[model samples]
Target: MAGVSLYSSPSFSVLCLAQKQKLHFSVSGDNQNVPFLSRSLASLRLNSSANPLPVCKPFVTRFSDSGSSVAESEPDSSVIKSELQSETLVSEPVKQEPKREELFAVVMVGSRQYIVFPGRFIYTQRLKGANVKDKIILNKVLLVGSKTSTWIGKPVVTNAAVHAVVEDQLLDDKVIVFKYKKKKHYRRKIGHRQPITRLRILSIAGYEDYPAVALSDIEPIK
Candidate 1:
């Protein structure tokens, strides 16, 4: 007699083989806390030999975060300083001229000395001993300094020059009268007309020609 077969069909034999070969999953003591990756670890391995690794960008820290480190990382501070210095060196210092002092001179007229200041007006006057309608000459001068005397040498006054006419005229008003309080007394009056002369001052000489009057030479008039 033939022994009865436990699996009669070929499909039942395949199913029993699959059940015997089924793999049982279990956690190892060392891998209990480890995560399971969906892809195999071998597939995640980088093929460095076939393809070059990507270079990582360096992190840039702001200057406000770390002052000393940021300053150290800055490039070529000395070159910037040198360039600024070179720019300043190219410019030249400005030169200035020395200022000169101004001098002045005047002509002495009558009892007064009329020194012409800057923008002063010039005119003429009559002298003490001038004749009627006669022109008078005046040579009074004040040398401001040594440089202004050269202009004083020429005849500063001229006769019949139109500039010799005195633009302003002046007269004395004081008069003397005689009277007698008596019977048959007569009263008389007398007046005098003072003689006047005209004078004109020419140009002021250079400072060098200025007359030097000593202290003893300047005597007070009585």
Candidate 2:
């Protein structure tokens, strides 16, 4: 068979022009061009494996309140994680503080004694001449108590007083009275509400100098 060479063929030159591409061809006449094709393919492979073209990656652009702009790459993992953690902390609910209890005392208002605390309100038997917004000084303190200590009066604590203001003059819930007599066919019913005065305890004074007993020092009842 005649040795037909592809080295000088026009098609061979066209194949070489295609850089970084696969090449397929059928050589039926002879194998004389095999060495040349192998050498050309090897050279093409080496050229394809050269350093790749420079890639243009996207960037993040930020604008400040002053109209200044800056470009930056993607945020670091640690920075992004910290931002998420800060958001979670901000989204959480805030805790509320516990309310502190204030001082309280027992005092006699009229014929009856009553227990009262500062900043609290209570209803008592109506005073004949007392009007709403009238300030009353109750000087019959029997016991003064606080979180730290307590003071007890023999009958009434001297120099101790409970200050209160009349908040309202109102009537209490109705009380029903019923009378029945068997076989006499007599029955009577009546409903009535007692008049009462609402007083807001303002302050308990004159017991702060007294000695106090710590709660831990007291033993529980057996």
Candidate 3:
């Protein structure tokens, strides 16, 4: 028992005993007691005498005819199709036009200079007497640039002018100002909003003679 494995022991050797018993049963022809497996092919033949599975038929739409043309055509398919088409058109997003290169000018509105283009809006320091819808022509154009050519002035372009209309005079966002003195314990906090004017650029003149760039010919910025 010290050197032998558990399976090799006669008391634990169940497989050997079963095999010996099977061989002894086979020699004695006692197959019924041994219970050997008997395999028979399954019957795959379906019953022709039984009712067949129900067959599904294609669905068919029926329209009623009441002898009146107006009543019969009220629920027409064409009307439904047109309604669906209209719904689809309403749901579809509007296609935006592609952006094209336009003439731009660098003009000085007040002490600060701004780059302006036609139909675009800009916010500048409040014009003193400018009112809403009042057109103002800016003559201090430092540079005018386009796709084909550029015009740069020494101090300011003479003929170059930018026309803009005052859209609104509004106050800008508040800026918090805080003053502090460490030793004296003096603290002051205040907020200020600078008055600004909104201007819609109507046109940039003097550069209309330059060639306009086509949408496809515009080069991508590197």
Tell me each candidate's TM-score.
0.24, 0.55, 0.51
User: Which runs of model 2 end up more than 4 angstroms from their true locations?
Assistant: 1-84, 89-98, 210-222
lDDT of 2 by residue, 25-121 (tens): 3332223556566546657877778956554442222224223422245557889999999999889688999775768899987888889988999
Better of 2 and 3 by TM-score: 2
Clashes of each: 19, 1, 0
**Model 2's lDDT to the true fold?**
0.80
* Model 1 TM-score on a 0 to 1 scale: 0.24
Q: Candidate 3 on 98-171: residue-level lDDT in tens?
A: 88666788998778989998889999999999999999999998888877667767777667789899999999
Q: Which ten residues in a row have the lowest lDDT in candidate 3?
A: 37-46
Per-residue CA lDDT of candidate 1, range 51-75, in tens?
7776544333443457777667886
TM-score of 2: 0.55
Best by TM-score: 2
Q: Single out the weakest 10-residue window by summed lDDT for candidate 1.
A: 157-166
Task: Count backbone clashes in candidate 3.
Answer: 0
